[model samples]
Target: MLEVGQSTWRHLTLAQRARLLGRLHATVSASAEEWADIAATSKELEPGHPLRGEEWLGGPYAVLTALEAYRTSVRALAQGESPLARVRTDAAPGGRLCARVFPLTAIDGLLLSGYSGEVWFEPGVTEAEARRNAGLGQLTPTTPAGVGVVLGAGNVSAIPVLDVLYELMASNRVVLLKVNPTQDALLPVFERALAPLIEPGFVRIVRGAGDVGAYLTTHRSISHVHITGATPTFDAIVWGPGANGERRRRANRPLLKKPITAELGGVSPIIIVPGEWSTADLRFHAEHVVTMRLQNSGHNCIAGQIVLLSADWPQREAFLDALRVAYEAAPRRSAWYPRSDEKLQGAASDYPDASWCADGTRALIEIGAGDDATALETTEYFAPILGVVSLPGTGQEFLDAAVAHANEKLTGTLGANLLIDPAAEAALGDGFERAIADLHYGAIAINSWTAFGFLIPTLTWGGFPGSTLQNVVSGMGVVHNALLLDRVERSLTRGPFRPLPRSVSALAGPGRFSVLPKPSWFVTSRTGATVSEGFTRFRMDGNWARLMGTLVQAFRA
Candidate 1:
């Protein structure tokens, strides 16, 4: 299959490739409900369960958004223009070029008003360098280079699909995808959605356990590999397993000769800067934090595992109390991932003083200064075990401390988030941007969750550059960057503090305000499922009526 694809793939024109993607977009949209159903069934989310929204927004809707981004980019290339041709660029704090990704279309401005995001290039990448180097492979697609293998992720349905699209569109390679065993039930839906590529022999989907993966990885035709699983799996494939693996690692001898990339889970952090807040502010952010930690039953690789707070802040206790309320408020879902139930029990047994939900599905441990946070900082617990640490200082001092701690203490550099009040943020001024520049993370968010980097197609998703094979912090390389940017340093996003209605307060001026409602992706949303369904349909056809219906659901949520 690889040999045949390479033979015919390069012969097809850019317009032909774009049309193939267009066909894939339609079929995937048609199968969106079945894909969501597969995900819902995985976690035992029965019909009419409010958490069904998790399947739609996080599962199918996310893939739909990626398809739209990639389709647009490919179409642009077919029209003799680079994907970055219409993009606006500016200088960050260090003169490194910043690509303005959000609000690329008029609809973006209306849908996510008051939101701003940018991708900061590596140091010394001037604007010209950035533009000229953008869309490296596709800008000069002379041939379909080779075959790549994608080891799909079990936790998220979109990971494998997006990876396949990246290999085909960005790298100009055909793909042979192997779905994780945990998500094998969704194989039929994936096959149906990807029929366009499958029929043309441009893409193929296979299923199996460890042996199947080992077979494909060692195949003579496979030129590159990518995985969205655990770090141990990467090490096992790169080096031999068990004692021999450690020996090979110590001697700098790897078993695999080909290049591989990954997006492994990490102990992500959420820093809450000290500031004055109204009652509504605490409640809103409390639920926001809950969504960050418990979304998809905390199976997300970018889930918020640790939260940093200021010990001297007057509202620390109040916000913590609010968080407790929010945690207990969310309904329980089954732990379908391997050993998730045992992991949840482990959290309760490990931390005696930890508070838990009624069903023990969520655990919160409070760690004061000098308390041991070894497990929280170094380990990526698959269960919903949240750790709260109180650092010293306030204002810019606290911000600096939080950045230093997250960079120096946390195990992985995949993602980190900061939540600061609008007024308090204005007070920080230059110190705030400086702190963001200093954080050693692939993706950073302000007043938002880092998972946004995963959903946004233009933003590069990976860990901070510098991790080696021996100590793979958050794995290596990147995907889902539809812009095909090179020398990407990190993705930075800032959003409105509150949702609509309350967001109309005096603080929400034109310069900095978002009219977005409580997003349907929020687990606590009342109409999340309905809103996500509407958004999925809207993405399918871009119909005005469908969008109005989705807006109604969002407002209700």
Candidate 2:
């Protein structure tokens, strides 16, 4: 199949592929509810469970949103125009080009109120250079065609399918996707949703565990390999496993000659810049931090594992208390990903002084100056455990220490987050953006979770691209970059520090009044399931009525 498609690849126009994506949108829409339900059930979410919304947003809503994003880019590419022209792009400080991807249209503004994101081109990339290089595979209507193997991610419903989409549209390759065993139940739905690509020999879905992935990656027919798994899996694929593999790895010799890329899991951090705060500020940001840790039962690659707080801040202890309260009070869900029980137990052993739930399923640890944070510093727990570490400073001193801690100690460079009081950020002058620029992460979310970078299709969703076969920290390349952007560095997702009703208050960053309530992605949200269902419908057809209904649900959320 790949050979046939490779022969015909040059003539496969962007417009035709655009229609294929259109069909995918329809098929996925028709079965969107079933898709979400199956995923939710597979992940131990019972009917009517609050976290069912997680599946809705992660599965259908995420893919549907990607389809819409790709639609815009494909149409422009079909017309021989730059998709970057469709958005607001300009030069930012340090001579890098920044494309404001979110709030793209008026509809985007209305539906995604108070949220915005930008993809920044790497340092030294001029506006003209980035614009010229934006579309390589898409604009040329030509590509080096071959087969790519996609090793699906188990924790997130959207990741595997989205990676396949990136392969077809951006890399101009047909995909042989091996479903993650933990998410195997969604394979049939994936077949149906992806039938447009499947029928055309552009894609094929296979199911299996590590052995199958290894087989596919090494197959002579495969040209490139991509996976969203751990670093060990990458090592096994790159150098081959066992003592021989270790020797090969140490020697920087790779067994597989083919090019490979990955978005390996990381020990992500949330740097909280200290400032004067009111009771409302503490509560709102507490929920923000809790939502970051507990979402998807902490199975997210970008989950906030360790929090860096300022020790000298007067409200530091108060804020930590609020975090403990929120962490305990947040709605509990099953840690559904494979091996979660063992991982959580390891975390419990590492932080013996940490607070734990009665069921021993969740933990929150506070690292004092004298304590060892070895586990938190080095491991991607990927469980319902969050650590709080206080640095000895305030203002820029605190910011400097936190950024150094995250960049120096963390396991992966995939994602990092910063939660700052707007006033404190203002006081930092140019230092805030400087700190953001200094952080060595692929995606940086301000006052929001880095998972937003994953959900937003246009944003480059991978780690900073310097890792080699020798040191597989986060992987080599990025995916879901529908615009076909190049010279990429990172994505920034900025959101208002407060939600609506409260956002109008004096403490809600003064002038920033948001229509957004608590995000539907929040585990504590009441209307996420319904809001995301409506969002999927709206993305399917652009029905204003459906969007209006979704807005109602969001307001309720």
Candidate 3:
């Protein structure tokens, strides 16, 4: 779709460049004011309001907060001021460490810290050189006014927005971001927050279903495409074969010649070793494994599908049973999107006796099978279905079997998770760490869910492209934490041996009622607003009393 003709890549004069940069900044800043107004209006049309459900709320504070944080961080780096030393350089292969800050909870306010070294992968750079490279991120790249089309996914609220941010901020490309019909309502929020870009022909939005997406992807004026959706969707765009659409598929090559980057779904796995676990530890991890299966009603790309069990160990049965019980008690969320129940039922029919968390409205079907372990573990169902598989030993045999099973069976190379106890780690030593390296995945999580890796701003997210483009799951390139240059396909993961009692993380068990709403309220609403505001103010004003107040409120939460 991108036609790089002779007229492309025009350069602006120095004066013109200065004017454009100032205008861009001013435009984005003024747009924030519009977003604030939208937020105020949306607040008035609350739950009891007639238009509440019909009109999606435009609470642009989150977007505004993100913009402010980005501006602050970039400005600071440009001015040679970094607090956390996240940017560092040395005379090694991966010499510089570059940290990118992405605030997950903007309800509190977005704050950027870190990014302290040479972000580039310079081979023989000193610490001073590394710092200088990081400072370059502060310098804004200029755009030549070409249209970039974005094929957005419906799952994450931030993916599309951030994709646009990447093209705009990093690539300096003008964008036309198309929203998935499933999340059509969020378009208004984007319009409000990115008003300046929208007004200046720098950004635009086109909303519809598959047809709209197809058009945009193949559009003549579109220079580039970025997608956050299913692998099937990407295939359709590049190769084309949906609903008897054979013309493009037969072509064998892509119709649109423009470069495309996609972050597709994956069938993520989580392996559990049955080594030295008390009943409590077993239960805690059981919940952890299942929580990954249940997050976002089990529609997530990184949700755990294959449960790698230590076959020879006795604790495997106990953990499985605990997981079943947890599922029985866990709330059955509304499938959330269409065709969810059909997929759930299809998965259940294969193994009828699989455990189900049902409450008339919805159900999470758990598939347990000892025979044909590989068969059930191959695909991502995009619904709440867990396939249990077992390996037959501990130590080297256990690790070997788990890794072998995953490699032999799983349909994805995007990500994997391993829950290893400290004692197990000590026993295996180098073998354990080597197994982690050997686990063929783009991202791996040790002792926790793999989703955290994607959520954390410090880590990169993407999978190997493999031989052909069609088979790739997670995707070829990485986006988050762009400061790192020579990243070996990111392993953004987290783990904590001892459990935190009140974390809303997937591992914790909250009986009958969900703790997330409470936690969200604690962080987002007026009760927490004062403290949050105080913390932000402290960065600029530095009042000790205000700082204490902020700390006290955070502690209470």
Candidate 4:
């Protein structure tokens, strides 16, 4: 790692930087082939059979999504219209966080509210005094381009490349990206896929461990630092470590302090309101919980950490049983990461009541408790363990109790979810609105998996105030959708109630069995392709003739 004294900023020439920037732009804009190769490589790194985790990361669906986003972005730029482009749900592009505004908004009678804080994209809208201290413009070199270093996350394959794209496209910065040790094997694939950028010096992949990361983070020549990982890692770089790290924090207080943005993890919670539901609803909700738990073996920060169920409501126990059955049936996942078993065991020790599915090879955990919102309920356990907590009372009472429970006990303020039915929402309209307002987290997703908001290019994902230049839980600020330049405390979201019953955490029953089948629907199938293509065509060409074309594609898939 290069110390402050050893770092050099003026080591590179102006002409070299310009050439590098040009190459990066051209390479990313070239063709869809590079993206396809990267996606395929990502599939190979799934730690297991391609069917389990590979399909989602770099599968056809993901490729299609990225390609569509790229097409839309270029088209919008060409038209000179800042129209929002629709990024298909399956394949999520990376650079959206650097855009002027989130392109995709709620359609289909569903509306998602952008954060209400004063918009900061334009000049002067920011508080003048605070703006002066932020040193925002200092990070943006007027010389057209400069060196950017990306500290990529190991768990996710696409993050490093995506971070590079965001910096290059959004900030007009050339980049030297460092792959985390965990992702070193995939380094060659990235280099090959991003050859155009690499050849031109616009982008280069340097592989190493923590030492390499520290070097890039503090390199004087590196103008910006974008990381997708632990908040502690980000903090250690910018502000040092521990409470005594105040010296570094103070030093960074008034200066540009290097433009650093991060997307950190959090203990995401799901609030299930009291509702009348059929057996299918129960099964579907159970499966939804299973999906969130089993996805990536629950390594995601947005993984459903806590389930706020209605304690007094009879459906709570039933839902638990359904979830248990679904989880037990889940295919055994390889113990991919270090300390995964230890972490799960630690959680089991803390919440002994929690259930575990260990058949010698793999472990799956579930928490079964009633109306207990303690530290165990709020903490983010990085293993496949789900805490089952409940709140007593009717729908309205449960809503109130649940919200209160989340705000008080949730470890990270990064995000939260509220699952409610249409009738309950209508009945408790004002109350529901008030509850949403009271939520202290950054992103609040309604009637859908919190991960959806993370996937959308239109949404900003992060945490609230307690996370500082030091300790960050929900991460320092938003990194996914770079719409706002200011600090965002929260993101409020709402979606269709039963769009996919099997994916809803509030339901308990046979619907739970359908979650696995849904993946085949999402990947390696024409269904997602047809529907996504139809939506894109309808939005672009506005052709009714293609509507049937879309449905037929889905049906055949």
CA lDDT of each prediction against the hidden true structure:
0.84, 0.84, 0.55, 0.55
Deviating ranges (above 4 Å) for candidate 2:
505-511
How big is the positional error of residue 61 in model 1, measured in Å on the Cα after superposition?
A: 1.7
How many angstroms is residue 431 displaced in model 1 relative to the true structure, after the best TM-score fit? Answer: 0.8
Worst 10 residues of 4 by lDDT: 89-98
| Model 3: ten consecutive residues of lowest lDDT | 515-524
Question: Model 4 over residues 349-370: C-alpha lDDT tens digits?
Answer: 6655555574643233343444
User: Poorest 10 consecutive residues of model 2 by lDDT?
Assistant: 504-513
lDDT of 1 at 94: 68
lDDT of 1 by residue, 1-557 (tens): 76687667777777777777788889999999889988888888899999887777767777777777777887887787777889988878766788999868777677667777799999998877787777767776766669999999998888899999888877888899999998899999999999888877778999999989988998889999999888999999888789999999999899888988888878889999998888998998988888898988888888999999999899999999999999898878866789887777777666777887847668989986566888778878877888998899999999999999998898889989889887888898889888999999999988888887787777888888887888887878888888888888999887888778767763634225657778777888999888777777777788988798778778888
Candidate 1 residue spans exceeding 4 A from truth? 506-511
Q: Where does candidate 1 have its weakest 10-residue lDDT segment?
A: 505-514
lDDT of 2 by residue, 69-149 (tens): 898888887787787877788776576778998867777777767778899888888767776777757766576668999
List clash counts for every candidate, in order: 1, 0, 6, 16
Cα error of candidate 2 at position 142, Å: 3.0
With a 3 Å backbone cut-off (N, CA, C), the pairs that clash in candidate 3 are: 86-116, 87-116, 87-117, 88-117, 118-130, 311-391
Winner on lDDT (1 vs 4) = 1
Distance from true location, Cα of 518 in model 2, Å: 1.3
Candidate 3: what lDDT?
A: 0.55
Candidate 3 lDDT at 452 equals: 55
